[model samples]
Target: MRSFVTFASAFLVGLISFTNCTKRTSSTATQTGGGMAAEQQLAGDDLTKARANYTNFCGGCHGRSLETFVNRKWQHGDSPEALFKGIKHGYPDQGMPSYDTTFTDQEIRHLVSYIREGIVAQKGKTETKSNAAVLKSEKLNFQLDTVLTGINVPWAMAFLPNGDMLVTERSGTLYRFTKAKQLQKIEGVPEVLAQGQGGLLDVKLHPDFSKNNIIFLSYSAVKRDGGQTLSTTAIMRAKLEGNSLTNQKQIFEAQPYARTRHHYGSRIEFGRDGYLYFSMGDRGGTKVNPQNLSVHAGKTHRIKEDGSIPADNPFVNRQDAMPSIYTFGNRNAQGMALNPTTGDIWLHEHGPKGGDEVNIVKKGANYGWADVTHGIDYNGSKISDLNQKDGITDPIKIWVPSIAPSGMAFVTGDRYSGWKGSLLVGSLSFKFLSRLELDGNKVVREERLLQDIGRVRDVRLSPDGYVYIAVENPGIIYRLVPVSN
Candidate 1:
């Protein structure tokens, strides 16, 4: 049996292998392919090992359900032989290290079969689910009404006063879905470094958007320092003026931009206090940023509408702290919403292999990330020995096997019976919507909604009190209209 440490190290190396698989006219292609038929021969224990190998090695980058490759264009050939060669020889130039040294030829063949199986399974699941016009939930029967389509990677959405909708796509575009159901591109959007996991992200309308045509966008901003490209989570405040953004101002930017492209935890929400609160991931600086209050990374920050640091912030008077920081020790927090009943800012962040968490944002509180995590590293290494400490604030809810929670919203009105006060959270990994029934701050019951709904990216309540879900990979926004009882 392969040691866990060895497998984890291989997993780390395999992380970048799937980024680019463009056909290379190289001498490596001349290598003889493995017996592709052997892939189907694996059964029982061999099959189990293949699943473990892929999860421990490939799932982090490729996604758990193999949904990453669902609608993706395979730059390289999708043939079994092509997959075998790619895995065995690897594409080092394209950031994928060859796996020939790590796994036996037979093991690699089994891995290829596992991937192919997942792809086929996912395609079948998607086709069957996508064609279903109506979906049933525990409380109400509703149908998916496609409002807008063809936008790739719809990350976040906000509703305007007059029933218009604003959506931000991760590929650096802001779109306005008018009440007339026309999709119009908003101009004057900022330039974003649309790299891996970094791009135009969350968008939110100002609380007083009716009185003031203001909107906020959270994105990954790029900067060149010392001839090295660096990116960080940033916020842009702008006035929406007739399908155009004007008076655009960069209200905030996370400091010490990182080289790594992923983990730009940019989620924006306005609290009842009218303060702009947004999340910033550790920028892959897991060891340095989350525990360090002096840096903005791995923190939830609070600022005034114009982006000024608030005097009442918990760390405002501290010399060694970033004044805007409201909480610390948070991993990549992607889902944030204000609790309608308690008015508390609730957030959920992605843990490593497991331990996705839902935390209530507290002033100057530490929601321990690397220091006290229930999750282990992607490579099966322990992130922290302690899951809880005295000063660390424990999560309100924790998902052992990470669902990869994304967008979140609290059902406010009676529009959806038996679900008014429930918390609706989108699952990116499982491709479902989770509705959590809350007894005050405690989650009493949990139910899965819109199962296999194409990677639910964002869920928001429309101005007229309807649940709207945004899904990626064919990127369509659907309104969940309840049926009469």
Candidate 2:
């Protein structure tokens, strides 16, 4: 596991320091006298058990002090029964699994009771019965929790059929969350570069997860500098076992890495045709870096499942020109998603300073980044009118000030019937999830969710119908629950 720095003070900041955890709009928990004073008991074997449980099951991801989101008001002051249901049901899709079977009712109650006591104390309240059925806190308008806290910066999540979730932290940590949400840091993931924006980044499960149990990971791998003086970018594939990764293989790697410290576009998805679609950044430089077909940077790549280039690729059977290049002319497009409905890839990339773009990814096409953009250069020089012409693909939507959109997922579940067809786009610079109403290929309506939450990095739909958002700050994942229409 890469040593991602963690501080216990992050816990105090995440929870109590914030006034509340309810979605800025509405909430479900209630803050009132309906529940008795909050108090908790932890002694002898009980204390030992809770500590052991947290250590063995959760310590790896949540940190020694459970700092991540433990400080949030919503995490504390929940009634035991409410806590039980939340833990028992497991927010699998959100990366919080239920641990009801592994832990007894008493243990859960005590654990939850302990959490409530901390909050009650924070609120300066007295002690009473261990209320189990009352409101967990104030009614929650949205769903938010500190799913797991201690792991290295968790980058992405993939759900299993049993409502379990496997998450990858940026610093090469792989962890498993039970359905009840007890996080266990899994061992045996291959060693990652863990340096300068180059650790494990994204993980997506095979569509037929139940049958294959196969998973894919994208990261920057270190390689010899060749005759020159730099490294390279490489993506690896692996099969995940209980606590380890097996058959690790490097499927793709870039030639001659940049001396700079950033920009390695690594997002992977299986297309409708069964070809693997992936991308690579331009290795951080200005002027036609990735757009050049002769080079490997700044390209949307396509390949076979086993790391072989497809014969029918855009440049099929070509020599120097990369046959894997599906498209070019991009800046750092960190997020890519296949329209679960249209079989088309929707791409969001960070454009020049302010012109962040959302584009319908095209095959064998170029998206004008340095050549034409609605944004200004770092020192401020306007590029283009965001026109649609010539050989460049126009973006479907562009943010003027730039929200720095990271990851996006189309809402397809019934949990929030109103948002069923909307796109949940998590914006890191904006610290919110932008909901875009989709009318076929057109985006019609837009709303920003979780304005109060920290930097939202990614969003996805849970199999159970809810949406999960990954926030980077203290690094937490929150679930959005709709209490009202």
Candidate 3:
């Protein structure tokens, strides 16, 4: 639910069978000690023929039902000769693929003897499944007012045309909330890297901002080399005056620098044609860096409020793309808006163990992550049942056991009159606040509104028509008020 950090060190246990088999051929059958005592005396039907040869050639994308490598921590190496040398020399630039001639090395040593004796004893154990499509329940007429409290892991917010409220705190501090709600913290904010899921993310506010007092952040910067450190997802351009943050500058960053903390798909919309769409996150990079076209990590760029690059974008003249790409095989897109009545442009990503999409933001599109996925492979195995292939792009809405979505908006003015254009979204793992209800771009119906109300990280809409929301454990900022019908 928007907090999975974990860099893998343990948690990978058993049960990886999804049916479908029969391939096993290529054989030179060499396995003396390297097979680790024949994977420790392979019992019962040779461990079900090494879990059916790893659910027939490595379950889809590495998942069959062992629930994706438990705690997961693979750059390659879990044992059995480091997963038989990462599946016989694969990782084809992180999209995997390399049976080094399709199995046979004794079927990749029985798929490394079923991942070291039935997937590391299936560590903590997990496999229940069935959330009925990620708990939607339904019910809405909304009302919830807290408006500012503590404030810490906030993440994103932007309203200051004078209504005050700037927030952003994945751990790099920066507050301001006041239309009397009072909360001030702002003090320059730059040096971020608040570790794991990197800090100080998103803040926006300058599409003209009452005459450019500009603003727009998105953090997690850091860079070193020698002993190696590197991080990405930058973008600053401050000058909010009053509660701090002046002159800043830095426009955009995010490239080949990453150590994997978690995707950083920042969000910072603008487009009515003034251009300035953001979003990065692919930070775990490689799967050929989201169908590579010159990385920017999974991508969803587009600039020119200052960061330039707008000569009709779309891979500008394509001398090898990356002219602020406008769409790609996105993976960790943490919500993005801009449809206050069909101005189009909407997105919502993050799937790995249960899809969770929402798409609808074309232009040079691709939208398939790790090459087509309906979601799997965190160790439950399989990552491709192909969620409608043939060129990618297809989401409208999806969300299996993952309601981990974050931040988003759309539902303009009229102080909530039957929830205007709806959209809302924000649910760091079921904290709740969905809404949806569109027709033109297709989403149909989906209620859910404010259930536990704690992890719902971001969901703005206040110029006056009210609808804030930004919750994180202790951090607050509510305001949704609109009771009756």
Candidate 4:
């Protein structure tokens, strides 16, 4: 297993803390409040067993400390009975599977006890949860500035030669952010599904946007006639004439449209090799999609700028495989960027509970996702028994208890002195920017910036070398400036 410097301390701040584990008792247990049974019986052996159980199953999603439960006010009740019921029945609609048959009532009680006593007790040992203090104490040199505000779920962005930016939202809207900090809704965008995780996603200009004036858009296109409607990620090319888009043409669409609306890996980038590359996630087809090559689901695809499959594509000659498939077995790779020096494709994907991964994508490689993973299922079940097997590429970095990585950009400009070559990865769950300092392809160190900001949806460097970011929740954009040492 690859070892990583975990941000474990960062997870503990801003939550409830306890000094004595023995006084806390679960409602489901036969013990009374602060009684002799609570101190003698439930303190030692039961907690150890509960912690072990949590690590084996729940830790992947909830973290070993049950961080998500600690950080959020529970919609389901916080009582032991409510927690036990939630754990037993599970919430399949919300990606958590039922554990009714998996664990007994006692085990579920143990989990609740662990949450109340073991996990919540670890908070406030430190004075603050603010990342500002974390950054200041670390003495990192950087400055964050708010660029634009009142935007909605800004998903992806691309810069133009004139310093203006084109951005996409998951709600089927497009906007152009000007150098003067003005926002204009671009006209003539296609109708999108805009449901669940679907909608207008990524926006990028053609590599030669200076001459062609072509902009590329990735969105969830709906196929509807009377009642039934299905949606899939599609790439469209349009001509940008001032604030309006003209000559719009869809270039590529992932095949076999599904009804599910999550996990559309729609990041697009132009490789140095002059091929247009885009990612299509597993589309919630975990068992069948990632392993199959005949379908485009859960795969990275490459095509010409005009949407034709590249003849030199990895699976072009395979009769049983889709010709556009450049690589297979990916699980929702939302972050992708070309390394500035190496020209290699670096991608970060969402794993089940804890196994978010960053991998250097190579041609025709299988990135083992339902078959092998470091994460378990949402219901605290194992997705696969093994983390590694033959023929699967291992990620260079894995974020345990997932950060929900989103947009990514390689730092290319000298405006930030020490960060010129680092990779900035946005996080939706943790609401921070992870600066990965790379030694060749391996991540040597990581610095989390702008923590507790809105969920970072996209990170892009402009032509002028300034770092621009899109933040969701209250939707806004911000720029990063270098601080002098």
Candidate 5:
């Protein structure tokens, strides 16, 4: 939606000449061999130009890959003539401006061909019709081995020192998948307010879990205030016994609980420096909480392993600020990971309509959520006038049109050939796993793997060096086993 001004400027450039050309009726451009001829005419430089044109003009709303329009119900027809007329005549009432005088008919034809080609490519990339058991990517061939099935809304997962797995469902049930492939429900999970986006969320183990037997769970903790139920992101630390959780203690809770059930960011991770790092969403208090550090929402926090605040936290010296705050102005960060190579914490947060972001957590940094954003509101309104400003840390990567990123992990070791040091991010909206090849902190290339796999809830590199993915909507867990080509 940040591209609205760009689109408006492009439209206004040819607005004065719009009345010069007569509008074409459907019969004027009949479906015939002419369409095919025009499409075939586009190749090489012309095709490249069309792709650039689309990225400039249409990628803001329609997405760069053009996957936003794929499989969705087209209000108007999607035929070549329909697209041609729609582009030339415009649908002003529907927010689609006509580009009648802006582009020549031949250029419009080239655009049509480019769009149709993108549709075909996206379809082919998503649909897996041949050999469902095995999946192939650009660099590696892999197959999915089903790990667990029939779990509902598996939100987060943790691997134990003994090779057992712990998975938390949004419905507040925790299950343990043993090494023998047996599933058993763990007891003593705290009650959660499983409403909207609030529920049981991330699970993490202590760095010395083998000796401490300590694990942490982040969830929406509910409390009644003034006869109304309110919830906030809370972390519970407990000892994991054979099949139960004991010595349960509430370690940290975001202050000023809200009535809104969504945006309880609850991703938990431990840094290499013997400290626990976690995230908190704005809790629908976008305007107030993110910029105001006195409250806990919309922040990355650091604490000692036993829930005590570290003396060296960024805001520890500020009398008015929360002592545990690491970074502030995050919207709703559901994905947090520790970069194995750099020892830096990486986080990804959801944007409103567009402008999903990936940022490296820095001490006392402001990410500029409500104050500055590349995104617009869900109802097509601008959130901020500026996308960047002084003192606000810009994201390392920004995904326009939003991927709804969740569960991030850095691939370490050479378990998968040619994929070492890649960052795997889950796409909840596109239902895919994104493999980002990084050059230091920058994402140089992105490859989409497991396209249309499911609503990917979590992705993690296990202790054994295999990449595991958790997906919802007929929830299932899968291990990505590399296969030799």
Candidate 6:
């Protein structure tokens, strides 16, 4: 399983729940207090009530046994509050709910206790719930009482004018979420090619969405290859009419034989420069295209949002090289960000075995993976001792014990005043959100949050002052809300 399980529980005792994901920033040891929040005055049953409320309201989507280690985080792991803030202010466009007004603080408390105790229970198989306040980070904190559950696996979501949202499930289903906290499935949607990792992958609106009503999607489309075993990733542009994708046009298709159910590394971000940056994952095997200097696989490419490469692309002079190649030599890079202050591309990719990395993506630079890596050979075998040595570029930061880095986002909201200039990497392995402070192109320090918030797959900052995250299967989209001023 290509997952990032970076935390070592056997050696870590009583560590609080935290978000853990690897990102490109220099590594510096954290010296903040390792402690839980103060035990505030509360009803003895607060924990129980919170637990029951979550079970009753959340189980509808996250699975009946939602506490069964979605990311398998063990003892001394991250905690549940990470999910709390998210549940209170869900990514309405993703079909999730908010209990901000539906439940009281006492009820939220019970839920946090239940989740914390549940993590401990997994280690012993038999343990009674305790009454201690769960631990949290001093610099970064999570809301424990709220939980993000019951949202279907949405392919993409777009916020509405009033801060509500419209989300499309990968299975070709669309839903509407209102600010009043109601989730209703929209009636029509284009049929998605839902096979593997290729379905309705990403959904974005034109910068003038309010006026043009334009939307775009990245999905795999079935393409006949001899018999019945092929499809390819394609980018389509369409306009939203009510709840359906209408007049969708195929703007881009990976060259022929782009038929893989997996490794459809598709993510499109509109740069402040008015260009679009797209990522394509390595199609399965250790080798394919990007590194070949002849294909676009496993690379971050730049193109006009209209799908044309700029003439000045680094490799435009070469016939075999794909003009979209911004940086090459990547494998399954899922997280991407453009720093709010500097506008540099921040990218994170899954590392084999170990050595997950966060890198300040530079144009035309080669990021060595199979060719150059800090990782051991899969199957625990030894490989070249190529870490910070080879001519291959080095990662700004790496997890010796892989954290299976997934999604990424910059901290721009006021809720995270201390983390204003930092980046958050969502970890599928460590099951928490990892924080990094940057000094221009370098990372300076690191910290972890939500010791138990397992397998954070996606981190997104809403236009509003909220941080939303997605945890894979029994998957859910959650929100980080600020406390009242």
TM-score of each: 0.84, 0.69, 0.30, 0.77, 0.75, 0.69
Each candidate: how many clashes?
0, 31, 20, 0, 1, 43
State each model's C-alpha RMSD to the native.
6.6, 16.6, 20.3, 7.8, 10.5, 14.8
Give the alpha carbon lDDT tens digit for every residue of 118-187 in model 4: 5457453321123232233143465567677775578888888998888887788899989898889999
Report lDDT per candidate.
Answer: 0.76, 0.60, 0.68, 0.72, 0.76, 0.58
> Tens-digit lDDT track for model 1 on 42-116?
689988988877765565446556766665545467888778777777543232446665566677778888888
The 10-residue segment of model 3 with minimum total lDDT is 1-10
Weakest 10 consecutive residues, lDDT, candidate 5? 9-18
Whole-structure CA lDDT of model 6: 0.58
> lDDT per residue, candidate 2, 30-92, as tens digits?
432222224367778877776655543333223323433344434322456556566444432
In terms of TM-score, which candidate is strongest?
1
Taking the tens digit of each residue's C-alpha lDDT, what string does model 6 give over 404-455? Answer: 6766889896876767878888865456788888887788888887654645
Candidate 4's TM-score reads 0.77
Q: CA shift at 159, candidate 4, in angstroms?
A: 1.4
Better structure of 1 and 2 per lDDT? 1
Residue 10 of model 4 has an lDDT of 14
Clashing residue pairs in candidate 1 are: none
Candidate 3 lDDT score relative to the true structure: 0.68
Residue-level lDDT of model 5, residues 156-236, one tens digit each, is: 999998899999998799999999999899999999987556778999988888998999999989999899888889999
